[model samples]
Target: MKQQIPLYLGIDGGGTKCKARLEDAQGNLLGEGLAGPANPVRGLALSQQAVLDSTLMALEQAKLGQGQLPSVNACLGLAGVNVALYANQYKNWRHPFAKLHVMSDLQAACLGAHGNQDGAVIICGTGFNAGAYINGQLTEVGGHGFELGDHASGARLGINAVRRVLEAIDGLCQHSSMTKAITSYTKCSNASALFETYHKATPSQFAALAPIVIQYAKQGDVHAVEIMRTCAAYIDLVVERLQKLCPPRFSMIGGIAEPMFQWLNKASQDALVDPLHSPEEGAILFARNNEH
Candidate 1:
């Protein structure tokens, strides 16, 4: 009887989207797929669906049928799995793969950025977080979710922009560039529309406003300048905390990384480095290293 070929799956499950890659035993690349957000906090059903959707797409690209799922070992690095309760809840969740290991998205990003070497990554997409892998030790900061934390994140910036707009309406703050920009973006000509738009907005929807803020700031808008200043300060705080565990060598990842990079001070900018591999590739490395 011939032995079956082994397959591995690596997933980067972020707050905004889930990405997956498939590889054979010898570390050769196979296929890749993408799906919606897989943050467990977003809801177990949605997360599971995203994981399945992305993994199935990957398998399809590899010319493998659904039956092959039972032969594949997988590592899922997901956002919102950092919370102990969510981790515990999702750890026992059903999946199609033969083996599955769940960890934080930041962990996957860090591993991907450094290729499992000692280094760190600051992720600033719809959410913010820093992960460090040093001396075989792992540490993470931020990623407290949209409600309590995620300072310097796209979502946070968007939220701040809206707040300033409201303040301006109330005659509390000057109607600076961001206020005009957000109001235009939201199409909220009146106070009621402004309230209605934000009240119904999602994190991704809010994050969409961040680029507008960036646009205005580049044109030297007063409010836009202050927003970036505050944003940089938050990112600086996160880096300072991570520095205690690892060196300043950092690769900034995610949708907002580039804009944030430009706003960061020269010292912080100096610390930024290029990633050796992508998060999905890092997930593959994680799968390769852990074979129980």
Candidate 2:
């Protein structure tokens, strides 16, 4: 029988979604797939299922079947794995791939952004995190999770907007168009209603309100402007911290990266460059380098 060609899979799993890229040993792209959230911090079972679902989708797109899974090497860059507990949990999963390597999504983004060269990346989506690669060492900052940190994140923006709306409804603060808009969006005209609606909301649910805040800020609403400015200031500080590493390249990525760019300080703005590749591609690089 002819020897089957080696296959590689790169998985980028985050709070919102999981993406997979399939490639042959020669670096030729074969297929790609996307699925729902795979952040193990939220739920290890859900994350594992998402990983398998996305990988299967990629395999199907490549004209392969489940049997081929045993021939594939995979590198998974996942959110929440930065924590030792979550990392250990994921490493212990009985996955089907021939080989599996797990790493933090921030590290994967940095690798992808610089095409494996030394660089840095800041991710600003439902959550926030920053990582830098310098002189073969990988250093990370922030990403403590929603409750403790995640400064300048979409979830933070949403939470602040809701708080402001509640304050306005209670007459503690003057209402602006932004506040009114938020109340309307939540369908909560009174403070009690607002509290009930979001009291048990998840990070993604809160993050859903981020666009409303950005829109109202663009329209010059005082509350919105203040919220955006505060978030921007936090990002500025993160940039300053990362700058100490002096990475050869720096990039900001995630759902809010572009929308929030104008609000950032000039120094933070000047530090960014376009990423050379997507995080999934970076995962592929990792799989290739680490394959035994």
Candidate 3:
């Protein structure tokens, strides 16, 4: 009999965007795909569509076609895996791939960070979330959606920083560089108009404001510095708690985490770990569906 060709796929689905990669059994990446936000909490339909879109896009990018795809194993690192509602809903998703493995985005980050060893990973992009993997088991904290939590996340930074700017403008807080910088970004004639964006903007849009905060902080803006500091502290608290929960080295992913690492105290920063691999690669590493 002629030998069958082997193929595999890895997916990193997040609140911001989804990334997919096609690889061979020996782990050589062949092609890639990019998709939309896959947060189940936002809405099941949206999450499912985004994921499916990305997956199909990936297949198209690889040019493997369906017959070759069915033999491919897929690992999906999603944003809202902890919510049983999401998981249950995901159970119904049908794909052409031979097998599919799903996990929280943090789990994939852990796999990317420690490669299946014991460790903790914090995701700090639009919203915050943390995960611990010990002995192949996964534990998670935060990521409870925007209103309930997600401290130290990009969304929180922007929301908080903007609020501070409003406060300063209204004499609620002392004047600072943050107010001037934020006011420039808002371009609002008056504070009352600021509500326009706040009322209509999405969480990711708010998060995009984080860079303004960071910029003001570098210029010695007290409010901006405080915002960044508070974010760092929240991240520290979560990681410290995870340490008690898992007792392993700590690592981080997402935009917030990469910057927060710089703001952490030297000792805490010393223990930081750069991701050993990307979440896309991590998906392929643990996927059992890959052909040998």
| Top-TM-score structure, candidate number | 2
Candidate 3 local Cα displacement, residue 228, angstroms: 0.7
Alpha-carbon RMSD, each predicted model: 2.4, 1.9, 2.9
Tell how far residue 164 is off in model 3, in angstroms: 1.5
Prediction-by-prediction clash tally: 0, 0, 0
Q: Model 1: per-residue lDDT, tens digit, 64-182?
A: 87889888889988888889988998878877788888888888888888878888888888888787888777788777998888887888888888887888898987898678868
Error of 1 at 121 (Å): 1.6
When 2 and 3 are scored with TM-score, the better candidate is 2
TM-score leaderboard ranking: 2, 1, 3
Candidate 2 clashing pairs, residues 3+ apart or interchain? none
Write model 3 residue lDDT over 1-292, tens digit each, in one string: 2214556777887777888888776776667888777788777788777766776776676665555667778888888777788888888887666788887787777887777667888888888888788876777888887778888888898889778877877888887777777778878646678877786676777888888887777777888888889888877777677867744677788877766777776655765677788887777777843433
lDDT of 2: 0.90
> How much RMSD separates candidate 2 from the native structure?
1.9
Model 2 C-alpha lDDT per residue in residues 72-125, reported as the tens digit of each score: 999998989999999999878898989999999998898899999999999998
* Cα error of candidate 1 at position 39, Å: 0.9
TM-score on alpha carbons, each prediction: 0.92, 0.95, 0.89
At residue 172, give the lDDT of candidate 1.
87
